[model samples]
Target: MSPMLDPRRLTPRPIPHLPEISKRFDGVVNCSDDTNIEGWKKLLRDDRPMKLAAGSISVVEIESKVLTTGFLEFDFVVEGTGDAPEIQILCAESYENDMDKGQPRSKDDRTNFRTGKLYGPTDTYFCNTKLSRNHYEPFWWRTFRYLRISVSCPPTSSLIFNSITYRSTHYPLPITTSVSSTDLVDKLHSTSVNTLLNCMHETHEDCPYYEQSQFAMDTRSQLLFSYTISHSDLLARKTIHEFYASRRDDGLLETHFPNPGRGMNIPQFSLYWIFMLQDHMIHFHDLALVKRYIGTADGILDHFAGRLNEKGLVGKFEVEGTWAFVDWVGEWFTPVKGFSSMGVPKAYYEKGAATVNSLVYALALKSAAEMCTALGRNDTTTEYLERAESIIQAVNEHCYDVKNGIYLDGPGATGQYSQHVQIFAVLADAVNGEAARTLMRRTIRERETLGLAKASFAMSFYLFRAAVKAGIYEEVWEELLSPWKKMLDQNLTTWAESESMVRSDCHGWSATPMYEIMREIVGVKSGWNETKIIPRVDLVNEMRGSFVVAGGDTVDVSWGESKQVKLKASKDMEVELVLRATSIHIKLLQGEEQCFSWT
Candidate 1:
């Protein structure tokens, strides 16, 4: 008899661009209007189109010389003598249509069909003045070029656009995974895909089927990539605030209710989403979002308050008796009584009662403090701060093992073993010198011990900040930038989902690691608080420069052997220079020369 078929090695269907040249799968442009009116849906309303922001992207087969995608890192340039050029590139390719009807071909069948440019970011501004006339990247599916450029306008509005240019990089377009039901290589993964770029601008409480929740919480967790792509914010305030705006009076805040976890029934990511939203606010200080969700933001606090146990803690809401996102053991954030899938041990979660709840509460409280303070709620601000303090104290009492100088939760001879707890503890600033030091040591030594429940980005940030605190700022750069290095290496551009050490998703929140690397690895601190200057040129040896997100005032700090280190800022203002060691001291005021220990 012939060898039987082995149902293992199944790769998900890859999105096809040209003739049979599929690489690895990435993302897509979703334009489905099936659930437009649903509370949370990706498609725009029937009356008009939804606000699709990403460039209409497709993975077209291209040889090395042909132009492809994006507007950055390309050899060509936009043309504009006196004004910016209006440029738009269209990416179209044949997609594999899995759904088939009225024929012998089943829905599982894969066949190629053509697709064209969908939509891109609204109110796009351009300022290219070099390649306006010859802005085309020819492809195998090369279509006709269309243009209606009119430069002479009302001076301020249309006159600004005079060129169109595209960015070409080593990053290749995604090829869909070709996995079928019969063949299974890895652990079970869901197989319902919509588009690579799934977005929902608005949702209402009355709408049926929490489709927005569906898109976000799907098994793929791919939507989380919105934060990692070009022009992305892995975690955005608007995403969470609008989600909150659609909450019902009963405070149920949407649910997968009947189906539970079968599909992306977001019975309640409200808590998680709100926490993420507040995180962005603190990092970016986007007051527009604060003002938009001021009232709803308070409403979220009320939810936390009402849900707290008699001791002001939440239960592991996802699964009972299980530790949630944070921990409640060792020198930890004192796990609040809440349900979380963020930071629980996979084994510990078998019976539910894993106790890594402390981290979530600490972050939630800190977020609360930030949101409250930003919203001008003085009373709430104080309450949240006190709550955060109390939680820290409680975590110390329960999760911390003072003798061992570590804290963790869960039921076991050794309890929960994690490093993310340490990261969150540092991020929350809830621990002390010795514990922080130990926690930092564990993270530097062991990377993935406790991040099972949390996202990899959480660990990345933890590593970055802990490195800064431990005065290994350069190490932090390597830790934080490692993920991006992998992404850039694999593809010229990053995608929503990844195939790295952790294959979840690429997100704006993940990209924040870049910001952390710039601020912490280089040891740059700002604000009315204490000032810090620890120059780190060591890590730059690994990669080129990176940008700082809406960072504070300009800074100048570095140490080099027989070299003049120049630090420039936006404006030359009064400054303070403090060195970590007297061995290299610099005292410069108002752009004056500061003496350094040049080795």
Candidate 2:
């Protein structure tokens, strides 16, 4: 059986007062100011309650000042001669235009309450008592920045709005790490942390809103983000085991776990599950943990191995019920007259092998080989490495577009190129060194002109990795982060699901900047056996932060424009400092500070 799930301890916090309020009605209301409603103010005070007449509607908007996940509580009393009154509560991360005007509404200022409107799932309640205080609270917690409540009474009844409050809830994971730099970077870091917090609870949810499912692809990135801030692997371990339990008879794992009903399967997500297992092995360095899931990893790889086509590459998933989701590119969502699949490229619908699917399978094989090497299983390691290399060679031989100087979406896929295939090609080692760098540079620079399919927020984590591997991270940093900067520019307190901003406003996958900021900007790279401090001095002049490494040890690093560097470790450990072209290896003693200058 899987490990016992950890119990969550949530604390209830009071919302002192409402931030902003607006009302539209057709009936009488008792208030000091007709233009300005003081009824909400009465909820805070115990003296006199805000009274609403029959048919009167009041929309009280409350801003928590930050993104939060929690249950809402409100107390009120009813006095009337007719039927019970109805209360409606709507929650949203931000306000938007009531109607889509065929333009990007995400660019509009979210703080201007008068111009935008709030839209989200609404919960309603009916008051039954005549003169006694009635309390109302929802069964499930909601994720929101804005909470709008409207109370309407019958022809003779009225509602005395006594008080309203909300109890904030989370997984109780304390963030011990910290990083700071320019205003934008700092905001990006803090906002990313908030977004991650909102998505994490009993399981690593894709988002607290909409579907609170623990998707494999989303959980992999989220687990890495958790490792940067907090050292506790309780949630990560639980998630890994749960996904392993979701395996089917065909050896393919379900896309998400804890799904009670008929589960959906995404072929690529099963590959991501192996990545999650490898990630746990890297951060925690627990051999027993790796051994436990290594069989499950092999089973998943074996399933893909059996599906290789005549060209020696993993073929398209023709299973009766499965999705081959690579990324959420707008070009892939085009409607086909007879095809049922949407949000996937046309090549995926055809009978050929997809370059992205084969590349991901190859990447997973390499990851599994690393785990096998750790366990001293040389034979298994050799088998996985050889299989991975063969798939990489097959993809290079069949999918490379000589004319465009890039990899195609699939074999014989003319004029169908995407950043996804290119990113995976570099990651899976199908291309390396100068070839990889040149291809990535072209992909980033000419994506718009070439009409290449772009990677949305969910796929950006891999996009950043490909850039780093190509040695062009600093060159394309600004362009890569423009989407997030746009969200901040639009006054978003949390990350949106995608650039489209049509769905969830708080997807944890979009919180990948937290991982990149810590790993790349802070330059604290922790591996399975060693910790490396290689600050990208070119990115920022000065930076400082501490992160939890393997075995629950803390490493602190700080550097400035003077080229002076100071670092310390919580215990005796081996550390490597990469300063430009030179590498200095040192041993850090417990609580001892190591000082040096790069110059």
Candidate 3:
């Protein structure tokens, strides 16, 4: 469980230098004016609408003033056709222990689940309201979604308006999106659609794109999105290659880049490139792109392999502390020692989250396995798989915290749910029957665990399946809809940058997984792997999809009209279908795959 943070408790941690970073990077981007700050204060502070649409009372436009996590506050703009509408706002705040570097919980502990109010932008905002209200304010307008502006009126009240009005100090609107049928978004929604989609584009001169020293990480609370998107891969690849060129006498890339243009040194995290490369493969299954990162993957695998001690577990380079693990946010760890803290002592090695080490072990060995497969090197493939299995065994044996039946956050030292631990365990596909069931139970039963409901949006996909495997399909389904419904209530279709859990921005790397859940498993995996499908049509699941896209160089289509589903992966790929009402043949070939899972 999460630890309690009181005025008395003290934990030395890295202070997010966003304000300082802001001032340092000023001129290129100017800070909001005092008036803008006042606007922000009013919006977040008193629930007042600083700017409203001329014809409406509830619909108002707002913008982010402070640059902390990349989210600027936005005002709710409801489009009332004719009459005044009632309004209500729901907000969230990070738990107190969230600010600390060393994890506050041991692997065996549960999330604190306790919430603290955000201390608002101004000192007075913090004071004006109850502590709970204070915690609800944005720290620096980090990205967020599931934002809702509820408007209610009598059936007779017909107040029509064109659109809601907002005051944007920076850009005119925040991220937004068009609503989809499957998603239940209904209230006033996001102002920007790109908030969650921009992470894959987080490149600067030294980022995946520019690799420059002058570019700032910009947002302090922004989470990591490792997948490449659209044209983003081209420059990201260039920056990564060059950064690796000088930095890699050894083969791995850092999981992150720091100091503007510099690459990260975390040996294990550098492996994110492998996962990213795999995602790129899934996108187009492009052999050329797969070949490009093949060498880089092998090098990283080898570098990490070099660090394994006699016991074979990779060390905690991503997080180093007094037995501390990845800081609560899951970034930057001391590379000092493998399991033991460098210069600290052999005993210190006993501390740290076994889950994180499990992640390194998994990432390292899996990357090696995938690289070997891409290279068609059998022996290397066998070697990496064996290594991965070893970690899996160790994880099963030591990391389970078996008596509790739930995976521990990490080593016993600093244990708490930060989302990464729970997510890493789930994604690794390492859990067995009962253990998987336990995890599924915990995912819904516990909301604050590892920020599962807040920060890790993609993590739910795995948890949902795990939950289904555990037999609570309905609850898992609700888990899926809860936030999305919150978004729907706000009239949104795409992923939100941040929900109550993350209470930040929707992420590109994170959001892409939603499609996987939508089409691949529930809907269908149509293209290469060339998933050949026998579509099921009863809607045993709550799927509302009509078409699924599959294939590459040659596309196969899977679609549903009434009850039947079909798949075709060849030139003008085709599928035989039977539903409650329609029977048809679909011709598909765009060198892509589609979904139509209905039997």
Model 1 TM-score (2 dp) = 0.50
Ranking by TM-score: 2, 3, 1
Q: Model 2: which residue pairs collide? A: none
**The candidate that achieves the highest lDDT relative to the unseen native structure:** 2
**Could you tell which candidate, 2 or 3, scores higher by lDDT?**
2
Candidate 1: minimum summed lDDT over ten consecutive residues — where?
184-193
Which of candidates 1 and 3 reaches a greater TM-score? 3
TM-scores, all models, native as reference: 0.50, 0.91, 0.53
What lDDT, from 0 to 1, does candidate 1 have?
0.38
The candidate that wins on TM-score is 2
Q: Could you report the Cα RMSD, in angstroms, for every candidate shown?
A: 19.3, 5.8, 15.5
lDDT of 2 at 29: 23
What does candidate 2's lDDT look like per residue over 1-599, in tens digits? 77598678784432122121222121222222355355565454442467778877666776766777887777788887588889998887777875665655553566657767777889989888665678987888778777777777787788887666677777867678887677877899999999998898888899998899999999999999999998888888889988998888888888888898646578889999999999988888899999999999999999999889999988877557777677776677646523335456667656366788899999999999999999999999999999999999898899888887889888889888898999999998899999999988888889988767889899999999999999999999988989899889988888989764477888999998898888988778887788887777777777777777777778888888778778889889999988785789999999999887876
lDDT of each: 0.38, 0.81, 0.39
